[model samples]
Target: MTTETPAPRHETDVTSGPGAVGAAVAAAREAQPWWAGIGFAGRKKALDAWRVLILRRADELVDVIRAETGKTADDARLEVILVADHLRWAAAHAGKVLGRRRVPSGLLMFNQSATVEYRPLGVVGVIGPWNYPAFIPIGPVSAALAAGNTVVLKPSELTPAVGQWLADTLAEAVDGPRVLRVVTGSGETGAALCRAAVDKISFTGSSATGRRVMAACAENLTPVVIEGGGKDAMIVAADADLDAAADAAVWAAMSNAGQTCVGLERVYVVSEVADRFLRLVGDRAAALRTGDRPDADLGPIVLPRQLEIIKAHVRDAVARGARVVLGGTESFTPPYVAPIVLADVPEDSVALTEETFGPVLVVNRVTCVDEAVDQVNASAYGLGASVYTGDRSQGRRIAGRLRAGMVSVNAVIAFAGIPALPFGGVGDSGFGRVHGPDGLREFTRTQAVTSQRFRPLMQPNSFGRAPGTMQTLVRMMRALYGR
Candidate 1:
């Protein structure tokens, strides 16, 4: 008797370099029509399946996240939990957000009936970052999937396995393997995805890379969404809660080892409470521990190369006469960086002007909230801001004046948790929202349909119109909108 040889299972790498992008995009486009034809109800069922699996198996997702990113389990948990929440929200809300809506035809087109609806763009490409590997791409992917567009995700090479696992998990639950796929590779893969034939590209990473993504997409005249780097600022008003503000600042600056784009990097406290706020914040920062231990409050900087940037920023700040109120260069122990708080930092220091992306915070004093608002708006990065003020009216007033995309009146990094709030930035920080109704619509194209319901009194559209019709239309235009 002859022994039979087992057949080998094979898989293709859709992330080998520039070549992978085309295959990934093609597969997604081919799958999109059938998936979209299922409409909102079918999509909701699939999304619900994904949400259920993600929540039920959160522990498994957390372990994978920790293994890939080196973030503490708790920090990793937050990302997975938030991703589940977004998937739930997208499933529950996409129907209403993308449903057809009727609108008034207005005076000039009174005889017409008009309605508008969002249609899926067929395929979408997403380039994710390593800091929040399990969470970041899900934002765009969920939104796109909910909108009926298949997605091709290129996760950061640092966390490709996590990306693959995520795709596999969702596909296994919904039996929609072709609806979503992962392409794991370096920057070249991302650039190729942009150049590939896709409806749109959503990128989350440094602003420098965002610019390149935009350039690559431009080659195909493809639309792009970017969530770029930020040097976010915080303001502590004179009437604010010093203790609460300090605690929030320290947590925001040190959370996820300060790898967050919207994390606190600079603070402008009113002169009246500057000293007290600085003392409270410095003490809290100094007390924060960094390690991979289960009980550790903070984790190491996940990206190995980010260490140099962190050290360089600290050195530049010190050279510019910034005083370290807490940890200094000594905190540059490899892998982990203890919380560092600087006081009396020059306005032009690198720590304040650039994204440190580490456990670093710089504090400055302002005479009043107005000056603080102006200073915060002065930064080229208009991603997000936090304002701690006792008065609601003052908080609203200052929040309105800030140029950032989102502002938390009395909290830090609170907007990102609410699934209905559109999260994005203005200026160099990046454009295109990734949550709420706007986010769902971002993956679709608008189609306005108009039908003539009746004959209008003007009848100017017909060549057979009366000679005086043109004069009457001109008179109406002058009466209604000439001013």
Candidate 2:
């Protein structure tokens, strides 16, 4: 969920129009064959060069991310570091993950050998969010390139500078014009990309805008992977490490101003330790700072309009018998929104149900881990969740029952940091995956090829078969199966 707060209302510049969108997609298609022809080894070499370049200029990239997104320097640095790791992983592993592999023919086709390979989807279109501008769009871009497809990316208008930096840096690693191109504009530009003839589209934003992206892609029947909103929860079991869980919740809720798709928004603590958990969480939240300073805990909300949504959620929750245990809506001063912790927030209130893209944490007491699971699963968005328990097995058991796409048993947002892990969500949180082997395949088309190793004793597909062939086959099936 990036800059769904909406871009400035204005007409987009060059490369932001429908004509430019179409031209970029057409150029990507033209360039894809040469990219795929270079083969995995060549692509890997180029991608590794790209990684080296990013590492060398990582400081510059981090500064751009922080400057554009208003996230703390360390937070922005984390994203840059993570993206570098993924670039390395994708380039190094794409061959093994997507290469053709032999498959045993089933009994009916024993005379044949089959194999499957993942082929590039030609041209890939990506629309990224502003929150994690450098990392979010780059996930799809790297996977697509590694999978041998050319890419055309449209970054959030709010952070086009970072997007431009990424595209330009990648271009230095290769000798191509439009292998990767950046388009900057409002929703209209995104709409143009969706309407353009692209093989697939990868979008990360609000569920509402994702729906619109899906609708626009439907005109061309372009397949899409929508990485949308999440009202993720943090479960605190009776046997959990209270201090660790509280600390994790604090960073998860307040870091990046809680604008993360998998950020912690709700907590369901067992009644036995609910009070202690609340105290710890409140202490951590109260101490956290959100200013434009160098050493602040977090930064301002990049999207200006997100303040209203944050304000409305806090106001609604307070109006419905909820108490602000820490900061309130009054702390919002334009882009900077301090962490706001709420207690006894109603189950159906906006604070609990909606995606308040701000530093807000809501706590609810559960009778047991089972009740906590039930409460967490009740959310409409299930992108990700975190479970804290002293018993590792109990954490796994609870994690298995949660409907989120990713679950971190002992840590918060650990799955995202692992480049080999498949990251995405189920239901409204969005469908499809990015990162890992699944991510490599996400932008590819599966092709199954077969070869006849020997002549079949009986050719059922042949018209020259004897009249009694059907009768004999039926008898053989009955004898083999009808015991």
Candidate 3:
């Protein structure tokens, strides 16, 4: 974890309470080995139980998210569904991925039978962001538990109520905070959780704070997985279904109040269809609304500081000669920042370079598909990318060139919803993956074993090795590698 100051955004002050965070950390540490001792089958049973509980009471869970984040009930429901999906996937696959499996011994050790297993890495600390708290935390929490490690999760202070709800529900299904537990607080609490006696830390938040979380975890030399902010891009090819592309781009950008890490922040459209795509995108953006109302398309920014940051990016872009194709130079409403789209923006504008994290999109025009791919790849953050095209080969080519962790062709942000796909970013967008089999192994440590079933015919361990033994070994090596 770096000592550098974190970028200003929304955070909580929950760490200051009397022994609140300390007790949470102590309890989690105390219960660590107990959870780890449960073996894979035991842990899976607990996870499955919790999954059923969550599925049965999903509406209540969504209601908690709705109260804390102010997102629509539907959005909250989606979060619950994502969590349930991950829990179910982890439960169903944990055994197959982590169980000890036999492997063929290499030629050098042909007398021995080998097996490889993924073992628990003890306790895991999960520091979650307010946005998609349920889904984000569980991506790590469920996998960690399924991998047979205890977890201590610190939910964002802005949404402590949701954290409490998760803790309560898990407690009912699992035993004594062994499998899953939650701690509520601001950065200090999260930092404390990082420094707690844990083998690894998982965080989902801004890159700046992610740096801080990494630094804190480094104090214990603990490994970390960060799902940080992204300046994701969506490409619109000339042959694309303009209406579908436009709708997806708008929805991806504006969903979750544009607070999604993989939200469509930048759009690159080929000049041949730029005008038509622009009109469609603008129409979709114009029809969007931001507020606390249930019927509204989106909700307010979770943190006031986030609103300031969004406003600053928009202001900086406008000053740098960018035209606001949609809402721009918006009035402050304390929480809600209206969705905005900027066009003809300079490449160096903050709206294009930095993560606005508000309901904003910066659309750029490219002369050809090559230019479109180049523009989409020209960013420090590469979490996710989407290319809309009728040509399958062209879409795959564009996706291959974009330096992102995940890419979707003819879809906006659909890769994340797929349980089989790995999720994480490269560069400053953060590293490591969650979801799919990759995610299942992220929380596990590989343990290799070799058991000698019989005495070797050519006893290399003995000093009485005959010259014929060397000849035999050489023959074995040659036979294996010659092909």
Candidate 4:
């Protein structure tokens, strides 16, 4: 229902309404059967060719991403690289993960043979986010395509060019029907896709919007995988390496202008080392600069409305008595926002309770690591988190205690890069997974088949069984299960 148009000024306005979205889904549905019938080896070859095209034209894709999202060239390039890696991984692993496999028929059906396999859903709809536009959407798209489903991608209105570029390159790499298509518009376009007759929908955006998407999909009882907003946290222990922890905190908080869904929004440090850790973090955050310059460490805030939210969070924190360790409200200058670091922020402040989605970090001192864990788990979000400690065992123990779906020990956002790990969140952060084996299966429907090898000694399915047959079965069950 949003009316805002956030694309850059020079970009042409291109949008698709409900009619066009329906047409696209229809086309994809027609093409899906052929794509699936080709089998795993054939599909892998096509995907590999597409991967090569992505590598060869990575610079062009990077330019499109930067123009739409206002991210640095390096940041855009990293996103491209990660997307390609996921595409490659999906193409290589889909066969083993979703192919047919035999299973035991069990004692009750010993005379029958059983097998299970993952079959492609007819069509999948992907509604991607503007932040990390290429990387996030490609994860689901590639996995869906690998699992033999056609996809209709509805990119965020702010970043339609990037989505079109992906679809175009894929078409050029593989000569076939339009198995992948891009539909560009605002929330109306996205809602249309959700309500369409697609077999499944994969959505990445705010938790509030996610609820709406779920409601629309409910009309048809269609399935969905929602990856929503996050208020991620970082914990620095008393025995942690202060230098490493500070460095990780700064990069994770300030990078991408703090628009990352899994970025560090808060930090909890034990009081014993809070002073030292705060000093290191303040120094690193202060040194960072934001601008369009090639040497700048950060870029402008992409969405106009998000800028206001960032400003409000800082003002609320300061009004609530949080001490500004580095930049404050004055750091914001329209599109670009300098990194801001706050210490001893009130727990109830919006900066601490909400998803700031800006380059602001709130560091609070805790009495102990247990107290830190408690505070981190208090938030409604459970997307991702990090723990730093000199003792590896202690770090692991803390990681297990966090309520987030993904946790990194002595590292920041490390689980995202590994292709084998599932990515998603819990609570307001949303559910369902994308990446690894689970991701491959997300776009598939499980099919279990059984064949009767021979007739059973007892005809339990028959209506007229001999009286002695029932007594014999009872004795066998007692002999097998009685203790």
Winning model by lDDT: 4
Ranking by TM-score: 4, 2, 1, 3
Model 1 per-residue lDDT tens digits across residues 151-172: 9998887777778888887788
Sliding window of 10 residues with minimal summed lDDT for model 4: 1-10
Q: List the residue pairs that clash in candidate 2.
A: none
Compose the digit string of candidate 3's lDDT tens values, residues 1-483.
Answer: 111223224444433432465566667667777877777777778878888998899988988787777887778888988888888888888889889999989767788999999988877888888888788888888888888777778877777667767767888998765456677655777888777757888888888889888898899889999988899998888899999999999999999888888889999998889888889999988887667665798887777667778888889889988888888766357688777888888888888888888788888898888887777778888799999999979899889989999999999889889877889999888999899889989998999999998877678777798768877877877898878
- Name the better of 2 and 4 by TM-score: 4
Off by over 4 Å in 4: 1-9
- Model 4, range 15-64, lDDT digits (tens) per residue? 67567998999999999999999999989999999999999999999999
Q: Kindly give the stretch of ten consecutive residues in candidate 3 with the minimal lDDT sum.
A: 1-10
Q: TM-score for every candidate vs. truth?
A: 0.94, 0.96, 0.93, 0.97
Model 3, position 284, has a per-residue lDDT of: 87
Worst 10-residue lDDT window for candidate 2 reads: 8-17
Best by TM-score: 4
The global C-alpha lDDT for each of the candidates, from Candidate 1 onward, is: 0.87, 0.88, 0.82, 0.91
Could you tell me the lDDT of residue 101 within candidate 1?
A: 92
Q: Order candidates by lDDT, high to low.
A: 4, 2, 1, 3
| lDDT for 333 (candidate 2) | 81
